[model samples]
Target: MEWIFILFLLYTLIPVWRQQRIHIARYKTIRKLESNRGSRVITLIHRQESLSFLGIPFRSFINIEDSEQILRAIRLTPDNMPIDLILHTPGGLVLASEQIAVALQKHPAKVTVFVPHYAMSGGTMICLAADEIILDENAVLGPVDPQLGRFPAASILEVIKIKELEHISDDTLIMADIARKAIQQVKTFIKQLLLPKMDEQRAEQLSEILADGRWTHDYPITGEWLKEFGLSVRFGLPKEVYLLMELYPQSPSRRPTVQYIPIPYRVENNDK
Candidate 1:
């Protein structure tokens, strides 16, 4: 009985130990990356619940508090100082993302995005406004389709299809009908905002792609895809930029580097 109990404890502890080790390793890695980087890197931390701001089990939602914090951080930088934004966001509130993007655009500093992991949905939209986007080989930036609660236009189409199948009437056209409406709604919303910055035809095309487009299976989008969408993207950080900083750590030139912060996940308590 004692041996069995000991074995169970060991088994349980092993996984916990491994998790702790991984967390420590990640912390060390981030610390190393932060060290001796000449540019001012402000990390915008975001880990919000699905709907609420402080609830557990973080989901893809942007809280106003977090948005305000980000804005405040940007304001803290001295006037005329060049800064870089190393963004790593899976995307949250569309409005919040827009607010941040606008601030970046208005800032005296140049805006650049560095994606070491994944930036999807609103993340990709934010990258669009950037002066340059730096993507690692493993990094992925994808689909900017806005979702209402949990329903994208595609999901709304699925729901309409189910309703039509159940009703079995002229209502069979409902799914197609709903899709059209959804597409128009998305297009209007995007056009009002993006049209001013982009060519009208290009903006419309992007809006359609975002509304009904499928999720990307490929993690990091190919350079061709980015260029096709009219984005200025580059593979890997420039060697000379890194080298220049290494040489002049004290008198380092200011450049925009968006800091990517990891979202925290909550563990469910079965006992609760």
Candidate 2:
């Protein structure tokens, strides 16, 4: 009985201990990056967190809490210091995103957004306000089109256009009205973020392309396309950025699909 009880305690405490160690390592890496860059480093990474008591993993996004914490970090930094935001979220609430974007836009020092993997929707919006956007060559960004509940705001408007006004339900009609406003609001905000980087004419054009219902909400916008749009985007992130990303391993709910000996290997050039 004593052995069984001891084993149960070990099982419960081991995960907690491992998690604390990961947290410590992550903070150490962030501090190292900051020391090297001489800028305030803030990370808004949202990935599959540790499994719950039920063994189910949950994901995070740019919510109010994220906004609050980031905002506080920004406030703590001096106005003259540059900000290096490492954003790896699937996007979140527009209000929170806007709050962060506006703050970044107004900062006197240069602001850079680093996307190691992907930053969708609201994440894209935040990138717009940055002086420079750094992305991994294979990473992607996403459309900033507004979503109304389960439906895209653009899709909601299309329903009204295709269906007769009388045939549309009262609920759908009400949602369509709100959707129109939401699209306009997002476009206006996007334009503001773009204006600093482009002329008024180009800002208006890019705003329409990103916020209008021209593409699906999850449409992957590559860095090449972003450059063509006249945005200051660059490919390839620093080695430290990739190192920090490894610290954020997702909690796997099932068997691992890929297996490899986790070390660097080099091919020998022995032809000589």
What are the per-residue Cα lDDT tens digits for candidate 1 across 92-165?
A: 77677767766766677666666655676667666666667777666777665545444565665666557646
Tens digits of lDDT, candidate 2, 145-236: 99998999999999999999889999999999999999999999999899889999999999999999899988999999999988999987
Worst 10 residues of 1 by lDDT: 244-253
Task: State, as a TM-score between 0 and 1, how close model 2 is to the true structure.
Answer: 0.96
Q: Please give the lDDT score for candidate 1.
A: 0.58
Could you tell me which residue pairs clash in candidate 1? 83-256, 84-256, 84-257, 85-257, 85-258, 86-257, 86-258, 86-259
Clashing pairs in 2: none
Off by more than 4 A, model 2: 51-54
Error of 1 at 224 (Å): 3.4
- Best-fitting candidate, measured by TM-score? 2
